[model samples]
Target: MHGPHVVVVMGVAGTGKTTVGPLVAEALGVPYAEGDAFHPPRNIAKMTAGHPLDDEDRWPWLDAIGRWAHERAGYGGVVSCSALKRAYRDRLRAAAPGVVFLHLTGDRELIGERMSQRKGHFMPETLLDSQFATLQPLAEDERGVAVDVSGSPHEIAERAVAALRAA
Candidate 1:
C-alpha cells in the first residue's frame, strides 16, 4: 500500500513547483524529490538554448520521474515535475498508482516573466509558450488538486497542504 499521501508538485518552469514542493514536504513530514535532477543532460541543454523539448525528448524523463515518485512511496515523498501533459501524468500514475498531484497553474506570460527574472535555470523563458501548449489541466478523475499560482508561495503551499489533509 502507498503511504499517507505523496504530493507531486507539478507545473511549468516558473510555476513554483521547486519553491512549493519542499514546503509541502516539510509540512507533511516527507522527503523532497527534485524531478529536474532526473532529466537527461541533452534535454537540459536543449532547453538551456531556448529550444522546447518535444514528446520524444520527454518520455524517458517522465519515466524516470515516475519511478522516482514510486520508489519511495512506501515511506511517502514529494516530487516536483513539469508534468504538463496528460500523457506525462499517465506515466506518473502507472509508476505510482495513487500519486496525488498538486498542480501550480498560472498565466503563461506571467510565468515567462518569472522565468526571465530567475537565475541558474536551464529552461529559458522562450519555452514557456510550448509548455503551456503542451499542458492538459487535471481532469475530474485524476487524484489531484489545482492550486492557482497568483498568490504568495506560502499561500499556495498552505492550499496544497489543506487539500491533501482534507483528502
Candidate 2:
C-alpha cells in the first residue's frame, strides 16, 4: 500500500479468488488479471477431466502469471491465482520481487458448497481435496495477508484491501 505493487490473490479452488480479485483491484485502483487465463490448453483439459495438476503442469502457468506480474511491478496490479504451494509462491517472487499475496481462506464445507454452485469452471469440485492438501499458508517471512472467506465478495475484497493496507 505504500507504493505500487502486484498482489496475487491466492487460495484453493472455490475460495473466491476470481470473484474477489477484481473488486480488490478496483478498490486499489489497479488492473486485474485472471490467473486461469495463463493456463495452457492441456492443463485446462486435464482439469476439466477431473485431474489435479502436478508441479510439472503448473510451472508454465505460474511463469506466465509471473511474467505479467513482473511487467506490472511498481505500477500496481491484482491477479487471482491458486498459488497452493510455497514453492509456487517462491517461484513467482523470484520472477517478480516485491509481489505480495492476499490469501483467501475458508472451511472445506463452505468452499465445497461454493464449488457446487459454480458453473462452467474447469476445476471440478472433486479436485477440492487435492487443492486443500497442497495449500501452504503464508509464512511469517512472506509479504502477505490472509483474509477469511465468510461473506459476500465485496465484503471479502474490502477485508483484503484493509489487510493489505495494514500489511
Candidate 3:
C-alpha cells in the first residue's frame, strides 16, 4: 500500500468482481478494467453456450490482462479476473511483479442465485460448479487477501480496501 500496485479483483462468476473492482480502484484513486472485456469473441461465445473455458482458451485472455497490469505497474489499477488457478496468478505476477490479488469468496448457493439474477452476462449459472472446481485459493506465499462476499458492494469494497491496506 505504500506505492502503486495493480490489484486483481479475482473470483468465480457472480462474485461481484466487476462491481467491487471499480469501487476499490476509486477508493485508492486508480483506474479500473473489466476482465471480461479482454476476452475474445470466441471465448465469450463458448461460455455463452455453457461450455467452461479450458486452460488453452484462457491463456490469451490472461495474457491480455497481465499486459494491462504490467502497463499499470508504476501507476495503480484494478481489474476483475477469475484467476482460478495459481498458475494463472503466476502468469500475471510474471507480467507485473508487483501485482496483488483481491479474491472474493462466497458460498455456491449465494453465488448461483446472484448469477441467475444477473442479465446479459455470458457466463451461465450452470458453469458455477466448474468455476468452483477450478478455483485454487491464494497460497500463504501469494500477495493477496480473500474477502467474504456476503454483503453490499460498498461494504465488500470497504472490506477489500481495508484488507489490501493491511496487506
Candidate 4:
C-alpha cells in the first residue's frame, strides 16, 4: 500500500471534494486542507459573478495551491481542490511529485443539481458548465485514483482510501 505518502482530493465542485476529503483525511489520520479557502478574494468575486477564471487568473492561485499540497507530504495532510486543468496538475506535480490525486467523478446533471441546492459558496450553479468545460480528466499515469460518485459520501471516501492504500 502506498501511503501517498501525501494526497489531494480533486474534482469539480459538488463532486464531493469537501465531504469526501475530511472523511479520507480522518481515515488516514492526517490533517485536511480545503483549497477553496485559499482562493484570492478577486477570484472569488469573479466566480460569484458567474464568470470563469482563465489561466491568467488561475496560475498564481494554482501555484499557491500546489506549493501547499507539496508541503502536506512533509507535514502530513490531505487537500481538497478542483484542480481542473492538466497544466495546473503538472505544476502541482512539480511541487509534490509523489502527491496522489483522488479524483471524484460524478454526472454533470447530478453535480449541477447539488450545486443548485448549495448555499453560501462563492461558486454558483451557473458555473458548473464552465467547470466541466475546463476540466481535463486525468490519465492513468497521473499517479492517482478515480472514485465514481454514484454512491454515498462514505462510499466515495472508502473507495478513495482503498485506492490510496493500493496506489
Q: How high is each candidate's TM-score?
A: 0.94, 0.99, 0.99, 0.94
- Reference-based lDDT, each prediction: 0.85, 0.96, 0.96, 0.84
Cand. 4 Cα-lDDT: 0.84
Give a tens-digit lDDT track for model 3, residues 66-135. Answer: 9999999999999999999999999999999999999999999999999999998889999999999999
Per-candidate clashes come to 0, 0, 0, 0
Regarding TM-score, does 1 or 3 come out ahead?
A: 3
The residue-by-residue lDDT of candidate 1 on 82-138, one tens digit each, is 888888898889998879989898987778878888999888777787888888899
Ranking by lDDT, best first? 3, 2, 1, 4
The total number of steric clashes, by the backbone 3 Å criterion, in model 2 comes to 0
State the local distance difference test value for candidate 2: 0.96
Task: Please identify model 1 stretches exceeding 4 Å from their true place.
Answer: 1-3
Instruction: Please give, for residues 63-91, the per-residue lDDT of candidate 2 as tens digits.
Output: 99999999999899999999989999999
| Model 2 clashing residue pairs (backbone) | none
Model 3 alpha-carbon drift over 4 Å, by segment: none
lDDT of 4 by residue, 1-167 (tens): 35436677888978989888999999988888888878888999999898988988888887887788777766567888788888888888888877888889989998988888887888888888888888998886797888898888898889888988887
What's the lDDT for candidate 3? 0.96
10 residues in a row with least lDDT, candidate 2: 1-10
How well does candidate 1 score on lDDT at residue 73?
Answer: 71
